[model samples]
Target: MGFLYQLGINLAALLLPVSRFFSPKMKLFVDGRKQSFAVLENQIDKNQEYIWFHVASLGEYEQGLPVMEEIKAQYPEYKLLLTFFSPSGFEIRKNNKIADITIYLPLDTKQNVKRFLDIVQPKMVFFIKYEFWPNYLYELKNRNIPTYLISGIFRKNQLFFKWYGGFYRKALQSFDHFFVQNDASAQLLKSIDFNNSTVNGDTRFDRVAQIVERAQPLDFIADFKNNTTTIVIGSSWVDDEAIYLPYLNNSENVKLIIAPHNIKEEEITRLISKIDKKTVRFTNYKTEELKNADVFIIDTIGILTQIYAYADIGYVGGAFKTGLHNILEPATYGTPVVIGPKYSKFQEAKDLVALGSCLVVHNTEELSITFNRLITDADYRNELGIKNLEFVLKNKNATKVIMDFIERNI
Candidate 1:
């Protein structure tokens, strides 16, 4: 299995240049890693002690952020080096203030792994949810580094739990500790005879809770809302817009703000053409002009958390297609969240549904009906919103829990 995994990694590294021609995202991926070693050699100071954190993408980075920040606060002497397996996370957070250095993680071949570890010389390492590179884990363990998997979620379907999974199971066992998000994950680890695990919940709840505490009123959003009930459609994709656009276009006395998952010109134009009502781009809108518009399209990123503050109801996107985006961002702001039907994989989404704090809609009609009911019934909407906020607050200490364990053990 190790040989096959190494062969696959080598194949991917060799074929990455060809993939760049077919996919722009793949192009970014290949391009980002081209100078990774050079970047490491140039930027990383061997004299400075470092704590390394690895995340697969933007979502995992957000999940691991609270713990990273707490670690930074507790050990100010240690510099932070963050790495991303995907370009989406690295590109967006390369200039982030939290880490002293940020770079794309090199491909997980033994040679590359050794080179990266030697350069960073991380005192401790953290792998965020769902990122398990066997080679890297093996190398870290060989060096006797204290490595942890934070906010880990495992399912029976994963290779680690399968009959022929001994090689993969070794990767799981490499972690000094597994701070899992739920009981099922802990049980899965235990089933594999890996007892170094704890159910510490998810650190994203802590991050979002911080966002809610620091949330301030956005003057432009306030002016645009104009005291009317507002529905924020955050991180919407084409499929999500297909289901909810018509209802938003025809609805009256309520404002809709869309922050599409992609902000490319073509996508923005396509969304605008679908909307029947007068629409204004966030970048182009004036405060006085907002009253005449029924739809507002956000052309920028990084403000979705703050946007949730002005939302009476939130429709998080992505569940209509691949999966669900972050519903907790809206829930943290005491807003009732609604998403599409395909959110079974997300534990928080399932828990929110079970708590009656989140509503699931299958199509345009279901979304319209759900929205109409929530918009008309203020008491019911507020009740659900309060429940969502409480749910977030109740799960707020996962970061502290993980940090406490790290302090004691590492």
Candidate 2:
């Protein structure tokens, strides 16, 4: 399996150059990796002590950020080397302030891993969530680097839990500590005799809680909101929009803010065509236009977290399509959240649903009904909002769990 994994990654590395022409995202994956070795060689200073943080994409980056930021603040002597395996994470956060340098993780083959580790020479390492490259993990273990898995989740179905997964299970031993999100994950590790783990909760709760603490008010959102029951539509997909747009178009005395998943001009234009009410785009929104508009579309990124703070109710999208967007972001701000039906897999989503803090709507009518109930009953809406807030509060300090160990060890 290890040999097969090696071959698979090498094949992927080889094909990346040819496959890049087929898609823009593929191009980014290929092109960004091409520059990674150069970026490290040029920027990474040999004298400075460095700690590494690796995330698969934007979501894991958010999950890992509180710990990264705290390390940056408290341990300024150690520089951060942030790496992303996906283009979506790297492109958006390459110039992020938290890390001294950011780059795509070079394809996980033996040669690349050796070269990367040689150049990086990190004092400690962190891998967010669950992208476990066998060669990298084994090499880090060989080097005796204290590698950690933060906000990690494991299930019975994963490779590590299978009888045929001995090669992959060995990779799990590379981590000096496993600051996992739940008991099931810890139990899974324990079942494999890898008990160097803890049920530390999800770091995202900590990240969002901190956002609510220090988030600056976006004046435009406040002015557009006009103190009404504003329903924030975050990271919406087409299917999600289909469920909510009818309620938006016909409803009054409530404002609509749509932060679609794709902000591409074509997607935004198509979305605008469906909305029968006055709409304004965040990029080109005029004060008068924004004030009068019933729908405000966020055609940009990075500010979505802050926007959740002003939401009376939040409809976090993607559950109807690929997956759910971050409901915790709005929920942390004491906003009642509504998501689509396909949320049984995510633990946080399932917990919120069971607690009646997060509403799940299967169809357009269900969405409308959910929105109407929240809009009509302030007490009920606030109650759900309070529950969501309490959930976020209760689950926070995962970062502290990680940092406490790091401090004692460092």
Candidate 3:
């Protein structure tokens, strides 16, 4: 099994270059990692001690950020090294100010792992959420490096609990401790004889709460909203648009702001064509022009979190296609959230749904009904928004708990 796992990793490395010719994303993945060793050697100080953090993508980075900031504050002597496996994470956060060095993680082959560890020689390592690189974990373990998994969530259906999961289970044992998001994850670890786990809740709650506290006012969004019933469709996919576009086009009193997952011109153009009413891109937005537009399409990034603060109702995207986008972002702003039906993977989404704050719609009809209901009933919307805010407040402080544990251990 170990041999097979190594072979799989080797195969991926072997085929990455070939895959790059066909897929731009694959090309970015390969190109970003091409100078991994060179980047590390040039940037990392050999004499300085460091703490390494590995995140799969931007979402995981957000989950681990509060803890990383806390570590930096307490141990200013240690430089932070952040690594991302996905191109989306690396490309978006390459200019991140938190980490002293940010680069694409080297491939998880044993040799690559060994070389990476030697270059950084980190005092400790933290793998955020769902990233499990077997060779890297094993190498860190062999070097007696303190490694932890933060904000991790596991389900019974995952390979670690399956009948033929020995190698995967071995990978699980490489972590010194598991700071999981829920008791179910802790119990799942217990079932596998991995008792070094704690239900620390989710650090994302803490991150979103902080965002809410420090949310800067967006004057453009204020000008666009202009005291109308504002519906923010955040991180929207094509499927999400298909469901909500009709409602947005027909509704008169409400203003709609869409921040699509892909801001590519073609996609944006396609979205604009589908709408019957006037639409304006965020980049070219003028305060005077906003009054005439029914839909405002955000063509840029990084302002989605702050935009939520101005939202009366938020329709988070991704659930209709993949899984779901961040409902917490809107919930933190006391905006009643509406998501698709496929939010089973996110416990926070489920909790919000149970609290009657999040509305889960299965199709266009359901979405239309839910959207209209929230729009027409101001008191109901306000009540749900309050519950959503309270939910975020209650689930926070996971970062403090994880930080306390790290302080005691390290």
Tens-place lDDT per residue, model 1, 185-260, is 9988888788888898889999998898888888888888889999999999899988998898789899999999
Q: lDDT of all the models against the reference? A: 0.91, 0.91, 0.90
Tell me how far the alpha carbon of residue 213 in candidate 1 is from the true structure, in angstroms, after superposition: 1.5
Tens digits of lDDT, candidate 3, 11-91: 998988999999989999999899889999898887899999999998899998998889999999999999999987888
TM-score, one value per model: 0.98, 0.98, 0.98
Error of 2 at 142 (Å): 1.1
Per-residue C-alpha lDDT of model 2 across residues 1-410, encoded as one tens digit per residue: 87788788889878779989999999999999999999999999999999999999999999989999999999999999999999988888888988999999998899999999999999999999887989999999999999999999988998898999999999988999999888988988999999899898999999898888889989999999987779999999989878888888889888999999998999999999999999999989898777778999999999999999888999999999877878899999888999998886578998999999899899989988999999999999999999999999999899998999999998
